[model samples]
Target: MRNDPLLSIKGLRVEFPTQDGPLVAVNNVDLDVARGEVLGIVGESGSGKTVLGLSAMGLIDRPGRLTAGQVVFDGQDVTKYSESGWRNIRGNRIAMIFQDPTTSLNPVQQIGAQMIEALQSHRDISRDNARQIIRNAMVRVGINSPDERLNAYPHQFSGGMRQRVVIAIALLNEPDLIIADEPTTALDVTIQAQILRDMRRLSRDTRTSLVWVTHDLGVVAQIAQRVAVMYAGRIVENGPTEKILKSPCHPYTEGLIASMPANALPGERLHSIPGGLPQLSKLPAGCSFAPRCNYAASACNMSPKLIQISSDHAVRCVSPLDGGS
Candidate 1:
């Protein structure tokens, strides 16, 4: 059913062993991506948005490890999947589209070769069939002359076109889940808008679930059906997109909304949240955000569990803001 979650992450914690100690990149995070749902994971840099996405895909390696929790994909406990086991899922059942295509694509290979390789890796398909699939995906992502573009190298395309090529590859398999980590960051405003439109259209037509990780609330407003607000390595708030945008309860979320260019008054100084993010290895004792939170009270001297505020909204604050503007 459309209401069913395609992926569920419970009590997730990701840690990296540092010289000082284990740096907790993600702390007790619980999240879900419903079938064909476009869920936005939004926060400032180093708030663990990317780490949580990678961990959900079982891509966290070595010093960075999943210290706790489970990542369930399509009812399977993917957290327990071995490297070899992950191969059957990664790029096949689940695909990730990175920000920069230049870094993700091979400079030396033709686009068609790369796309064909990706298809053949998971599916028992001939090169001719794979080429047709690749061409179709490229067209779906709005790439002009998809057949000719397949012969061109990554360098032959512009920044926007390169990203489209990456999207093409991701969609070639028609994966169940697509983890797009800031996929629009490298494009200009005009190009960014166009790409986002194309992605939304394709997501709807294909019924592919998307976990779009970004710091841009504007983008979230346009693409996401639900939003998760991460702060200091944990989800401080999450709910339907309109609710999160209009009536953010978490102070950090309120600050982020206040800092938006659209939210600022003309000729007035822009709003900003005071203080820097705490270093995970040496986070203060108590709530991680208590140091910077203006409304923090005595009860905030300890971590607060996520509390249900409504059927579709939840917040993690002992003193949440009351539908702040």
Candidate 2:
């Protein structure tokens, strides 16, 4: 992996303006993705993994604008750029694939049309050239009878096929960064594995950095070079995947590992973390994870910074090494 980061986010805060007050979905988040690296952001449903991914691409719009922080992409502060600057980078330099392809794909248009549009929108290639490129992309994604599938609508394809098309669209430009939000959630177990493998292999071959946003730790272990555990909108712990999964330091991280259905402990009782995520409208003052953190102490009441546990790892809570929830 490259020592210099491709994307860097610092003090990033995203809030939704409401009648009562502002609702903070993502708060005080800081992360970095290096070139040719896969950084997995793992968390429960409401922990803001999806929101954080969207914000990274400067995709937050309208009432849910970024409150504070800067997104440094290759040394440039993308957060400070006007609307046009973001337009230039999005889909061209950085591409994103969402969980539901149906939601992002056009139902009226054929698969070929959508992919061709994506190519032409970002590149100066002619329609004929773009069509050829799209076919090659379909073939690269393991699609058989690529020519026939090209004319089919989104509804005509299986869930896995649609996702592969979505991925192909994202890869059409060979972007430097790709952020996938639950890209495998809609597929079956077998199909999920295939897509995951294709994604990892393609990313490595192309030397593209990826941010895989998902609640699935198993997927993280399978494809990510590093993992960041998020809770209540903040990353509780982050480090190399092998190190963090093998020996988690944060309470939240520990619970997630113990509760993994894909790789549960042998002959050990499976334990789930108590309490659900807190309401965004009324967040806890200190560490947002305190209510569910078994290691909560008096110091936890005063918000803790991300403390370094080792050279490559950092945990948000004051005494994260004490453990468990």
Off by over 4 Å in 2: 262-269, 322-325
Specify the poorest-scoring 10-residue window by lDDT in model 1: 316-325
Best by lDDT: 1
| Native-referenced Cα lDDT, model 1 | 0.91
Which residue pairs in model 2 clash with each other?
none
Looking at model 1, the pairs that clash are none
lDDT of 2 at 56: 85
Compared with the true structure, model 2 gives a TM-score of 0.94
Give per-residue CA lDDT, model 2, range 1-325, as digits (tens).
4577899999999999887698887889889999999999999888889899999888888889898998999889998888888878888789999999889999999999998888887779998899888888888888988899989999999899999999998988888999999999888999999999999999889998999998888889999999999988888899999989888888888888877765566877678788888988788899888898887888888988999878889998787774322
lDDT of model 2 at position 179:
96
Model 1 ranges off by over 4 Å: none
| Residue 110 Cα positional deviation in candidate 2, in Å, after optimal superposition | 1.2
Q: How close is each model in CA RMSD to the real structure? A: 1.1, 2.1
